[model samples]
Target: MPTHNDPDTFTFFPVLIGDIGGTNARFAILLDAYAEPKEFPILATADFATIDEAIQSGVLDKTSLQPRSAILAVAGPIKGDEIHLTNCDWVIQPKGMIRDLGFEHVEVINDFEAQGLAAASLEPEYLEKVGPGETHPSLSRVVVGPGTGLGVSGLVHARHTWFPVPGEGGHIDIGPRTARDYELFPLYEPIEGRISAEQVLCGRGMMNIYHAVSKANGTEPVAANPAEVTALWSQGRDSAAVETIELFATYLGRVAGDLALIFMARGGVFLAGGIAQKILPALRQPHFRAAFEDKAPHSELLGTIPTFVITHPLAALSGLAAYARTPIRFGVATEGRRWKA
Candidate 1:
């Protein structure tokens, strides 16, 4: 395979794109600049010892096309050559991928950055509006997702280019506000001392809320996992489960609203993750929007800022494909996050 090292004129043709999260890894291949991405089935991260093995068995073995470049969105910060996932055991080393998989170039980014990119360009059909508001094309936007962990990022449009700002916004401090929150907040399991947003916002966080609610009600917790909790909530048979889902929605809305205020994200605030999509009905309720617009002094401003749940399952892949096809359209910073042979 040929290699292109010139940063300004590099081409990412026949690219292998991946959205590697804590529990699952989704892969796809973009044949060229003009072709649509060919997607593959989702793979459990634990099934393979390394990402290269997973790619070889789950992607390369099934496709006839050879991918020269690899673009991966991982569930952690891009620190150095070796990237460790925040919630999984997979350690992604770009150099190892190039040496073992024979790729010419590799780029690793924070998973939420891909969501931010998708938010900047996703069409209306892929978005389900959560409440009433309009999108301001010229303003900034934010993307928050709660899956294996909480992912947060911001998108800004400047000089005709979309820029994604990725950070550990998931770890921001979150506190109780209402009387019910005061009763349940103390019972939640904290990471160290205080409760961060991720402490009660992700899959495990759902269970944390469930357990806390059960403890508050002085009843034994019935749900073992997030899915079971959701099922019980849907059936309305368990009060703890129902309250857990309701609290999760309210907390999500509060955090999203906080981010919207921070970025003044008039373009919109998008919710992307398994939990957000799975609990669409809960998010659509009045409580979610009420919590989102509860900001004092600026509640009216937030009311005009729209919120949406991203309906597309392969949204991160779409973002990577867009960047691979038209690199100039998005100002994705890849100084230390990119490796080339």
Candidate 2:
């Protein structure tokens, strides 16, 4: 990678930010400070093999303003300085890469964390409203996305600002409501003794549901793979694929409702990621909504809160940038660290 000179003048061009998920990595060249920065041009992961190659590509070359800062939203756990990408072969470091990428400051946050940050600043247009009523500004907002894996996070509203919490909620044991889930272990038991929400809510989760339903129906269950299943569904040729997606959405909605119950996320619930976008058209279907509001006695409480699908292509990138601007306190985790005014 080649190093470039930074422009001397101080103007707010969009900070070069990125969000790298299991499947793809997206980068931006902007001319503003926020996630909603003006004049953004996006580039795909397939366009370049290495992140550095992608950053220094023709897009950044056209900008006379050299990016002095950056933030990357990467999926998987960040243990110390090194990041071992779960879905990809890339390994990244925050402090070291800053110098390498010609950035004065850089941050590589958890992908879910980036989503949490983006969730805080989401506008009405970026979301597709599912359930009725308005978001309760006082309630905690749950953000869950079923993509490469089932990612979960929450934004707690305290006095003023939204505090983002990043955790391994996906690894938590799923509330297996149906007989199929109870019997799911025999297939995935080789990997672990029991399955988590991620096992049945992610991309592979779709396959797991398809096969389980196949066995339940007393027939040979066939859907080529995740991609093939999605493709078939796209063309409206596979009922199994459709059923699998429906089950996935239902379970996902149930999980969201449960999270809301836990966090009292009356603020709202957001379905994010590429997978949600693909299934947004189907989410309007009956079964999906039924499973979501299937809560016991207090089911009506969920009806009061709103549910939405985040449709923005670079929603996570916006979050990664927003989080980057937050101040880091010397001690304890508390509010007043991030300012958006």
Candidate 1 backbone collisions, by pair: none
Query: Candidate 1 lDDT, tens digit per residue, 67-178?
Result: 8999999999889888899988989988988898888989888899999889977888999999989999878999999999999999999988888999999999999999
Candidate 2 lDDT (Cα, 0 to 1): 0.69
Model 2 stretches astray by more than 4 angstroms: 1-14, 34-50, 57-63, 179-190, 215-222, 234-236, 321-341
Local error of candidate 1 at residue 282 (angstroms): 0.8
Give model 2 RMSD, 1 decimal.
6.2
lDDT of 2 by residue, 1-341 (tens): 11111222122334666777777777765545444443345555656666677677744676776776665677777676667777776776655556566676554556877787777776778989885758876668888998888888888876556667767787777656777556644554223676788888888887887777666666676676777777777787767777777778888877888887887888888898888888887788766667777788878887787888999888887665554444221011322111111
Q: Model 1: runs farther than 4 Å from truth?
A: 1-9
